[model samples]
Target: MKRFPGKTMGLLWASLLVCGGAAAAENFEQCKTRLFNQAVAQGVAKSVATEAFDSINYVERVIELDRSQPEFVTTFPSYYSKRVTDWRINKGRELLKQHQPLLTRLEDEYGIPKHYLLAFWGLETNFGSYKGKMPVLSSLATLACDKRRSRYFTGELMTALKLIEREKLSTDAMVGSWAGAMGHTQFMPSAYYRYATDGDNDGLANLWESIPDALTSAANFLNNLGWEPGFRWGREVVLPQNFDYRQSGYSNRQSVSQWRQAGLTRPGDKTLPDSEVSAYVVVPAGHQGPAFLAYPNFRTIMRWNNSEFYAIAVGKLADQIAGGKGLSASLPDLPAYSRDDIMQLQKTLNSKGFDVGKPDGILGPATRAGIRDYQIANDMVADGFPAKQIMQQLKVVQASETSPN
Candidate 1:
């Protein structure tokens, strides 16, 4: 899972101890004694636990690392195109050749196909070429100290500490991503506790140093998430003429049979199967672009990352890894509008007695309904999606109404 930025468990506990008055110190001492007395807590040897904690300082540089994600705001094509480039594909192929036996064994054991694993590895760190340079302990501990989501961060921090106590990971060796996600596939502290395994059989699930453990852990995670071995995530679908534009969001789910009845079909196929599985259509742009009928697996991918564009990018990368061509659908010509602009548009519509719902920047169903109402009232095409022209018109109307002649 992509680790959300927040306080770490260590910082939370520390703050509680420091700020909870004299009682806090007493409680801390008691808890420390109890933790130390409990044998085999984090699976680490007892000898290194106190010493590691005593010397480590929660560095503030970790904040910079967490915030420096330049690629997060980029267009999907730009971000994905770079990740799925020939260099990555060739490198992935090379890694596959070198580790075929290990990958084959993992696939057999975990029932997760190898391509998805490769896709994650290739996408995450370019096959471990760049796991991250930050110290996991410092990064996690710093976030924990900040008291941002102290409860959650404290849990993760405790987990990390437990890992240290168990000797499963050496303090010096536990380096990882900016947000404290370690190894090739970027397993966070919580994930390390749950899914990490000793694939190389070195007595520890050392994701930083061992490729086998990282890949195995990743496959284990996906398998546990109900990934189907032979089933595809999604395929491009063709929308019929005069299709309801509002039915393009992620929440729109209909069975394949229902979609067929509604005149939706796969891009190249004429007939739709009468399968009971639910699916939804997403048109990244307006009607001018290619569309897709996303299946349950697509939602699963979103569970890994909340962004629609990110999930689609990962799916595209996985297809590329499997030697399939990139998305055949053309993106809509609509230049992306700023998120702020979208929010402002929603606010305007809501103030005008259109129920845009919550004024969130997301162009969701309620927002679409509001846009449709506005369009109908103005005698414009009720296409639902709020284009630049609609926003401009709203601004002009607002300005005129507010003007002091």
Candidate 2:
């Protein structure tokens, strides 16, 4: 999958690329025709567009993977364990030394640290061990013909065609996740079009083949996403026993000194950095879980992946690879939720007048806020995390809800 929720282009640019929102109802052949037309209309040469179409087909598995994307399904521990492993950290440390010269240059030029770039690489494609094997053209085309995200995927499909024409890449080697995110860092075609760099002086930015090119392109993307030079992503903190959970969360940002005054301290009870940097406290696994005071750079990580779980995983994995202390608190064993379970929670919350704004199974500020409000109203802890107890109270799950098979 690609980094999502980034502002890749303007509404006008997207509108220009999209002409097939209603193509879902049409047969694959018909939708394919519309897509080829849209690609040509967006300035992809007709020859290039036709060649791409000849190699594309509707992939049933792509649509299945899209509907059940791990982003919408996995819980924090499940996501973290799989992503921030010892192998990735150990390998990343070796890579840091192996590519020292290039990484240093990239940091000097792009202001993104080597560890962060490496962290993204480990998380995105396991340090290039597996850069997915799905056919990119077919994946994007299938998604473009779907009703749910046609406009967005249609735009990506058109850009993928442009990338092929520009790079003269073979469709066979241009494989990626079912979502059409390509190469080592899993960049969508739009991101590829914008930030790809020719780091190896190969006269092309081939993210799939050139390690230098992929790393440099990743650095460029992070810099564009607002990475701050010489700043840490965030740090784990020990919250006061009587800390008010309501004050926790991204929206309720406060100065570091203010948080220090409010009894937040480093993991060993050391005083905070004493800076006036604006920061927010995030208890990703809830009040019982660990806490981190997120900084501006943390939001920059979120731009790379809007999911708080993924962002935190990136930070923790980077720290581990750098020989930093791991989390002070062990992750509590929690039940993993399927989309249907979350949808049920949303429906239940709406019935009680929380109005979570139509739950699409993805956890966001609205759902967290709704859960917080509901908890407060019912005289429960207002940490905004949907623990199993709260789930039972809301009747979103059974007495023993386990993960989906």
Which candidate number has the best lDDT? 2
Q: Please report the TM-score between candidate 1 and the true structure.
A: 0.79
Work out the TM-score per prediction: 0.79, 0.86
Candidate 2 regions exceeding 4 Å error are: 1-26, 69-73, 338-340, 353-355, 359-362, 396-405
Error of 1 at 180 (Å): 1.3
Candidate 2 residue pairs that clash: none
RMSD of each: 8.3, 10.1
lDDT of 2 at 269: 71
- How high a TM-score does candidate 2 get? 0.86
lDDT of 1: 0.72
lDDT for residue 94 in candidate 1, whole number 0-100: 74
Question: Can you tell me which runs of candidate 1 are displaced by over 4 Å?
Answer: 1-47, 61-75, 333-336, 357-386
Q: For candidate 1, write residues 1-405 as lDDT tens digits.
A: 755346776687777766755553455445444444442274544666565555445454665555543422244445556666788776767777788899899889887767668877877888888888778765665565554554566567678877765535678888887578888888888988888888888778877888888898888888887776766677778888878766766667888899999998866666777888888887654456667788887777776666666667667667776677766666544646566677788888888999888865666668777988898788765667666789889998777767896
Report how far residue 217 has shifted in candidate 2, in Å: 0.3
Go through the candidates in order and give each one's C-alpha lDDT.
0.72, 0.87
